[model samples]
Every structure is written in C-alpha cells, then in structure tokens.
Target: MSHSPAPRRRIPAPRPADGFMLLLEAARDLRTVGAVAPSGKALARALTEPVRAQAGQPLDILEAGAGTGAVTRTLIPQLAPGSRLDVAEANPRFAHRLSELVRAHPHLAGRPPEQVRVHDVHVERLETGRRYDVIVSGLPFTNFSPHHVEAIMDRYLELLRPGGTLTYFAYRGTGRARALLASPAQAHRHRAVERLLAAYRDRCATGRRTAWANLPPATVWQLRRPAYAVEHSGTRAATAEGAGGAGGVPGPAGVPRTGL
Candidate 1:
C-alpha cells in the first residue's frame, strides 16, 4: 500500500492578549495629555449590549477612538457570524496596537486582512464612502470645543443611514462633562456634544442617558436615527412612547434594530 503524504501542519489560533503590552505603550504616546480612560468593564458593556439589542444582525459598525481594543474585544463575541467592523482612531500608536489586537484574537483568525479595517486618521478626517448601521464612539466629547464637537457630531450623524444607532459614553465624576467644563479644554468637548445632540434630537429613535455604576460614574448616551415621520423631542424620555406620549410613538423595545 502506498503511504499517504504527511498532512499539512495547522497554525495555532492567535492569542487574545498578545498586544496588551503594545496597547499600553501606545496609550502613553496619545495626544490626550490627561484624558481619563473609561473603565474597561463599563466600556465593554457599552460595546456588547448594543449588538444584543440589535439581535446580532449581520451589519456594519463604525467605532471612533478605539483605544487598545477594550471595546472591540467585547463587541466581537456579540456580533453575528459574519459581521464587519471598522475602527476610526486619531492616535496612530493606539490604532496600530488595535490592528495587532484583532490579528491576535482567535475569533478573528483565518479572516482576510481587509475583514478588519483601521483608519489611522482623525475622526473628522475620515471620508469613508460607505455608511454604517451602527456607530460606537469613545471620543473625548467632554474635552472638545463646541465647534469641534459640533463638527464631529454632524459628520457622524450624516454618516448614519436612517434608523442607524450611535452609542457613546461620557464621564460623570471627576472626568464628567459637568466637571470637565471647569477647565477650558474639557469644557469645549462638553458643549459640543450638548449642541450637536440638541440640534438633532428629533431625528433619534432612542435617546437616553444611563448612569453607570462603574467607576467615575459615567453616563451613556444612545441614539438611533429615526425612520420617516419621526422627530426629535426636546426632553429625555425613558422610551420612545414616553417621548411620543399620547401619540403612540414607538418604544425602544419594539423598534426593530436593522441597518438602513
């Protein structure tokens, strides 16, 4: 009997934490002189829950200012079998580290390099031809100037296809918007988010702030682009119905989470 040729050797899956050291090094080189980092656990929650709420639909996601893959790590497991994600980061060091992290994850193994795209450019500088179904951001909103904040907000809002969701979190304690306003640099960031959201309040399907139990007590802001005939209300409502009180506005629970 002829002996069969030796089987080809299979490569081991990548380690999820290989880039941990690199991520820390990159963090040290960021432009943020003293920005407070969001708690990893809270950041993870902010990334995962939105996918669950969307029922793990195969869709496009845009993440801004992804530092060291904290949020991406949490989001990967929550994605549908073939979901695609794009990260837009201003810090080159952090961006490079993020790219390395994806390559090291077991779930990300065997995928084409293009499966994960990273843009090492300012969020404001990105001009992607494609729109996204969801946009997750950890930008330093509380530290930007009003103009900068407005610009970023308007740009992202324009990028969102109708009915898309934009999820973000703001610090509440020492790093909170209210507290940050005491300093000029951080104050700009706070005002920008306020102005931008106020300008587009009516077009959101779910606009609520969640007070996190995590350290620094941050607040999470989540908004979804509205379908036809939907409008932004001035006040914060617990659910869509609350915002549309007496008029049968849809609630967050019933709104089908799908890409526009």
Candidate 2:
C-alpha cells in the first residue's frame, strides 16, 4: 500500500530580535532605549495608522526610533509601490539589525532594498532636505528633556510635507511612576516634558488611540501639519491653521518599562 504524501508547509517570516534586542539596548541606555519590550502588535498597528491611511499613494514615510522593526513590520506591507521608508535609530546595533530586517522583509520583494534606509542617528539629526508624507515615531518622549523633545518635534514637523500626519506613542501612566521612582529633579524633568507634549497635543492633535493589549499599554496620537504650511528662511511668524502643538497625557502619567 502506498502511503499518502505529506502536505507542504509554507515558509514563515523570520523573527527579528523583538524583545530581546530591545531589552539589551535598554540596558545600555534606558533614557534612549526607553522600553524593555518591543511594541506589541496592537500598539504597532495603532502607531502605523497614518501610513495605512495613505495606502495606494506613492508616499514618502519616516519611522523614527524604530526598535527591532516591530512597527516597521506593520508599516512596510502597507506602503504603496514606489513609496520609500527611512528609519532612524540612535543605537547602531538596532540600526544594523533593522537594515537586515528590511533586506529580508517579504513586502520588499518587488522593489530594490534602496526603498528602505536605516539611519543610525537621532531623529533630530536626520537630513532636513527630504520631507515625508507620513511619519510614525517610536521615540520615548517622556525619557527626554523638554528642550530635546521640542527640538525633535520641531524637526519632525519641519520634515513633514504640508498637510502631512505624524503618529507617535507614549506608554500610559508613566508620570506617576516617575514621580514615585525618580528624584525630585528627575521628576521635574519628566513633568516638564509632559507639559510640552500637552501643548503640542492641544494645538495639532487630530485624534488618539489606546492600546491596552501592549506590555505597558500605550496611547497613539495623530497630528497634522496645516496643508498650507510654509516656512520662510527668516521670519517671526506664528504657526498656520491645523498646525499647532499636540495634546497632554490622556490618563495617569506612567513610567513604563516597555520598549519602543
């Protein structure tokens, strides 16, 4: 009697470093690495909504502070053909790993690897000449000083094309934790960043989403730059319509042990 043939199995996607890499990087620098675990699937989806919404268009996208390609996985598949993605990570290891992930990503099969670039630099230092239609940021804003966050935010807005959308997340309930676990001075720094973020949220925020399924949970905000945004080389001008600051923390301030 002839035995039945075994069924074929499909190849699966390669798993990137994910939590392991993020944890290692965090150990190196909690302030820069931020979280202990990589972003959850739910959180990744929430953070990438702007890129999803722009599907079918040849868009220019930027993913800042991408850690282990968590959100990058969700994003690359949604990019319309001919679209390009630039990833900025402050950690050299993460950046190198991200480059490898991008090279092997199935979504990039049809296009050259040049479509995706990983930059080992802080988001603020990325080249300014190129503007993006959508930006998904994974930076840990709460860990940073207000001035730095503001500068980064300004750079993000500056890099956006008119009417572009920016999406970013902060772990929920981090403020209270900071107040309890940190020195008064450190706590004060945390508070300052919160206030700065609040200012931005108040002005330009279009909407927010909560991802309770994540390791420490998170809130994603979508902010828009005014369609008519125009910057003169030198001028003391106010921001344009729909192009203001973002909103404040939605709930309890949290200092989460989660990674970007």
TM value for model 1: 0.68
Best by TM-score: 2
**lDDT tens digits, residue span 1-260, model 2:** 99998654332243655677788888888988888988889999999888777679898999999988888888888878888899998888888878877876767775877788889998888984688999999999888765577678878878888788999998988888987898766777677677667766776789999999998999999988767643323322122112222223222122110111
Residue-wise lDDT of candidate 1 within 1-260, one digit each (tens)?
99999655342323354355444544674334224343456655864566778865787788887866667777765656567788897777678877777766666666666666888987778877877788888776644544455457656766777777888776665435456445543444444445444544444536555546555565676777655433323232221212212212223332322322
Please give the clash total of every predicted structure, in order.
Answer: 8, 18
What stretches of model 2 exceed 4 Å from their correct place? 1-17, 230-260
Best of the candidates, lDDT:
2
Q: lDDT values of the candidates? A: 0.60, 0.77
